[model samples]
Target: MIKPTERRVGYGVAMGYGVTDLFGGGAFAIIGTWLLFFYTTYCGLTVLEASSIFAIARVIDAILSPIMGYITDNFGNTWLGRKFGRRRFFLLLSSPLMFLYALLWLTDMNYWYYLGTYLSIELLSAMVLVPWETLAAEMTNRYEERSRLAGVRMIFSQLGGFLAVSVPGLIMQFTGKDNPFTYTLTGLIFSCVFCLAVFTTWRCTWEAKDVQPEHKFKAEVQRSSGLFNHLKYLILDLISSFRIRAFRLHIIIYIASFTAMDVFGAVFTYYVIYCLGKDAAAVSAWSSVGAFAAIPGTYAFMMLLNKLNLTPSSALRLAYSSIFFVLAFLFIVYYTKTPVPDMVFFGLFILNGVARAGLIYIPWNIYSFIPDIDEMVTQQRREGIFAGVMVLTRKSTVAIAILIIGMVLEEAGFVKGNGIQPESALYAIVTLMTLGTAVLLAISFYVTYPFKLTRETHKVLLKEIARRKLGGKAEDCDAPTRLVIKQLTGYEYDEVWGGEATRRVVGQVNCSRVE
Candidate 1:
């Protein structure tokens, strides 16, 4: 029988744990949507200058993301880790530091000042997010409970996107859109939200018990060496995650799916305003409604996975299909000059909204189980490293997608800060928004076919890991469990959980700790 306290992820725990998405989702939404406009209009920076700031900061943060992951993974060996826990400590530290995000919106800042502030906020976000992301896996082992946690998290994330889109517009209504002070005030409000959300997460969430002393000692020994050696080992450790077959597939799907969204996001406004000859206010209204619509969509996806017992991959295909249909409908209506009603457009946005929630939900929901798979091979928990790598890949791929979109538009004779565009530019916008998105979704859909992780298989994998941890031999595995292990890890039954495969992968770290 399950103990009463075993299921600590009640509604309160899930709410507290998920609330951090207010910052996680809102901060990015605000920055991505408004920062460039704010810099160019009020801060007296050119488009190139503003874009360069983001590029420089993102490049710097991409490097730090995995290092922060590696640090937290081994941090259990430290005095601070012993006292406060490895992951939540960063949440506590970053709570107050979130206020620095406000500085990025302040006007009259020089280029260097903007760069410094933007870099600071990005680094601060990574420091907290990389560790905080590992908490769901650390807190619970049940598939349903973890799904609940991730589902709530995505809902809040959608809400954050809503607030990010709406709050600034509300502030502008009172303060006037042209005033720089409006953005500064908006930043202060969001900073407060971020601070409170992170603090609540720290207070309400808890980490797992410490790992084995031997593992901790080995981590300490590696850190005790020269900085160069420590860096080398960290690099090796980060790369080692790719050796896990499931993670490799997960990353591919993640990159392809999200990059598709990025391309669509970058081009959609252009498609609406330029291609369809709609107003900016209409686009903003559509975006706000879409954001709000995602809340229910997220909940519905949770049901699809939890109640309906749909695999994440199947759910993902459904989402991609919905989005694919939306894009196609929009393209067809515009190309054929169909007299579509406004309500119909609104309905399409609602459908797209629902689909996007799955796009955000499934990969992350599936992510909570990945550490269990990793534990089966290494006999250790390494959620931090995987989180770090995911963040890094996310940032890098998004940057590339945005860059490609910009280049393609520019090549099509698009001009910045101009109300009108050439005919070719409009065509380019529709093509990227429709065909480009469809292509990426196609890639993701194809990749998902080979993916075998589902609710049922996850249970099997977890059972095997538990059995092995309790000193069961791999040789004694049942045929069904053995097949599942081989399918998931691409390792023979006897080659996992500290077997020959472990030595082969572990030996990549040429340190005395393991030898």
Candidate 2:
């Protein structure tokens, strides 16, 4: 149990972490959302060139995700405690690097320079994010508490999104100019906010100490085998995790859901700018509307989750269904020249915000479920690996989306000097992309239907884990035995499940006693 004082500190840590994470979103608003438009319209890059830069940067970041996860897991500095480990050390070192990275947005350079800067920023940002998200899972183990904490984090995260989308218009209004200078100012301000939040988290947060000393497990293993043997064990452990059917399903759902979401993000700016022929001012207004509405929308979904007693999978299914219908309606309105008034657009934007609430909330909530299932099956707490895999999957999708969006734009006869595309083609592309992604999301959620680990199921799994005491002697259980036990009883067993008395019994006697 956590002490009262520690809980207070944890809340503080959540706030600080929340702010920093949001800052990254804000930076993306200026850079990722607007940068493409800026490059194609303002910087005079061909659509192909701009797309290439985004695609290449994302690919590089995707490759870095798992390696970073491995490093985070193995880090063992003892200045604080075992739980804190090397995570804080890296966070401190990486904070300023994150700030420097945002400066990439301010650079007025050629295509190659833009490519290099974007890649550098993404790499540094990943360094901060992988550890940052891993720490969230480590903060607590309670299901309801995790949901509440996620709620708090999402509230602040949406606030950052709000600021990101809102700030450009504010900048334009204040500066009396719509130019690169406005973007530079926005980037600098966001960097300051990001740094401040990170510093506060570093100072205020405290990690729970691990009962075991650092490197204790490593020392025992090293006494018996060479380094190659340890590497082999690590590989085997990772492979073994996939034997859990639920975990494997969860991973598949996560990859597909996140990939579709990223693809939507990669193409959204083009839809707004080229398809709608809307300027930054119009995009900012719509985005701000969505962001502000998301606060209530997030809370609403939390309530829906509670009231409906829906599993994460069910909630995601409902969300995707709603999003698909909304996108279809938006497409029809845009394509058919339905004379959508400004108020109607505003309403749809608000609905988009509410829809977005699910997109952000459901996936992470589902992700938290994986570690619990892993702990039950593996009898080892490997939250780091779970977090690392999630990071890897998310970035990999982002990379693919960037590449696909680039190719699509190049094929559409997008050019630097051209103000926009023909209305028919533009609307068709935006509508089809959004609707197509919705279909993919729906299919992924359906695939996860069988892997149902509801609150009741999770409790049962936990009770079984505790009853069997599988943590101590999991290695002794052969694969066939593990699979049989898991299938028959939804639990894994080890030597601790049956002591010397049971072991000493003959086969018939043991079988009868087990029955």
Candidate 3:
């Protein structure tokens, strides 16, 4: 029987764990919403030139995220991690690094300097975020609880987006357009907020007990080593991670799905300003409603996943299908010049909002579960590796996507600081917004459809992971069978408690579901 204390997490801990999303969402939104425009208009670079600079930084991510994940996962297995907290140790340092945001919005920096600044922020964020994201897997092994954690994080992520879109727009309204100081000031303010949330979370929670490897492996890892050795391990860790079948498929499909988002988010304000021929107020109204709509949409997705009892791949396909249908219809209406009433326009934003919820939370919630699969293979908890790849891939795609969007704008003859764009540019904007979005979403669906990992398979995987963690040998079950077929290998003793066998047989174990 599960003890009461074992089953429930404190509200403070849960909320604190979640509040970091406010920082992540807000910071990313600020960059996503306006950084490109800032480059084009304020920094005096052409769209193509600015995009080139953004693309350069993506090269850095090829090394950055995986390294951090390797460090964090190993660190959690080390003495320092055991004493001071694995994930929490890094988080403590991450908050103060928020001050670095100031440099990003600084003026008089040349393109090279700007590239360095952009990369610096990316480095700092990875230091904190790779570990932070891994916490979802560590914090709980329960499915619905993981969903709740993802929900809380996404709701705040939307709030962060809300602030990034609305507040900055409101401030810039008074300060006038492309006022450089406006960005500097916004950076400092949100930087403070990000730091505070991170520190507050650190104060409220402790790291969950991550499973450690046997002594020989642990000792070799803990020996302070040179950079070359570290790089070797990172490469090995990555190789180990890619061995998981579902992860490879998931990453490819996720990239395709997220490209649509990167393009749409990069284009939203531009579309409103140019295609819709509207102002900041209109953009704010649309963004605010959309962000607010995501909160309800998150729970709505949770309910759908629960009630339909769909497999992850199936649920993902359905979600992407909804997005495709909406964007496709919106394109047809706009392209053909159907007289869209104000209500219809707002309703489309509402639908977009709901889709955004799935896009943000569903894939991420799935990330926590994937570590279980990796753990089954390596016999070590490696949430950081999987989480790192997810972030790394997502970040890489955003870089390519933003550059692509910028190039598209330049090709269409977009001009900066001019309220009006040419008819071709305007046409390009609407077409990209509608049909471009539809095609990408459809691609995501097709990418996801062939995968396995059904819902029933996932439950059995969780049970098998629990069995192993409890010191019961699993006989290295077949990956495709998902632990339903068990060969007797050997026995495992409870490492922490130093007790008798938690189990010798794989026959039914009584594990209760905790909320």
State every prediction's TM-score relative to the real structure.
Answer: 0.92, 0.83, 0.84
True-structure lDDT of candidate 1: 0.82
lDDT tens digits by residue: candidate 1, 1-515: 44322656887889999999999888987776667667766787755566667777877788899999989987877888878888888998999998998888888779999999999988998998999999999888888899999999999999998888778767767776456787798899999999999999999988875433233112122234778987987787788788888898999999899878877776676677778888545666777788899999999999999999999999999999999889899889879989888888888989998999999999999888888887777766789899999988887777666656666776788766566889898888899889998998899999999889999999999887766556565578999999998878878878776566665555432222342
lDDT of 3 by residue, 320-435 (tens): 76777666765676567667776776787777778788877777777777776654444456777877787778888778777777788889999976789998888888777777
lDDT of 2 at 170: 88
Best-to-worst order by TM-score is: 1, 3, 2
Order of quality (lDDT): 1, 3, 2
Which ranges in model 3 have alpha carbons more than 4 Å from their true place? 1-7, 77-80, 106-109, 176-182, 209-226, 307-310, 466-515
Backbone clash pairs for candidate 2 read none
As a whole number from 0 to 100, the lDDT of residue 335 in candidate 1 is 93
Q: By the TM-score metric, which is better: model 2 or model 3?
A: 3
Q: Please say which candidate is ahead in TM-score: 1 or 2.
A: 1
lDDT of 2 by residue, 347-449 (tens): 8878877877777776666566566565444334555566666666666666666666666667765566476676554754685467757766876768757
Model 2's C-alpha root-mean-square deviation from the true structure amounts to: 6.5
lDDT of each: 0.82, 0.63, 0.70
Q: Would you give me the overall lDDT of model 3?
A: 0.70
- Ranked by TM-score, the better of candidates 1 and 3 is 1
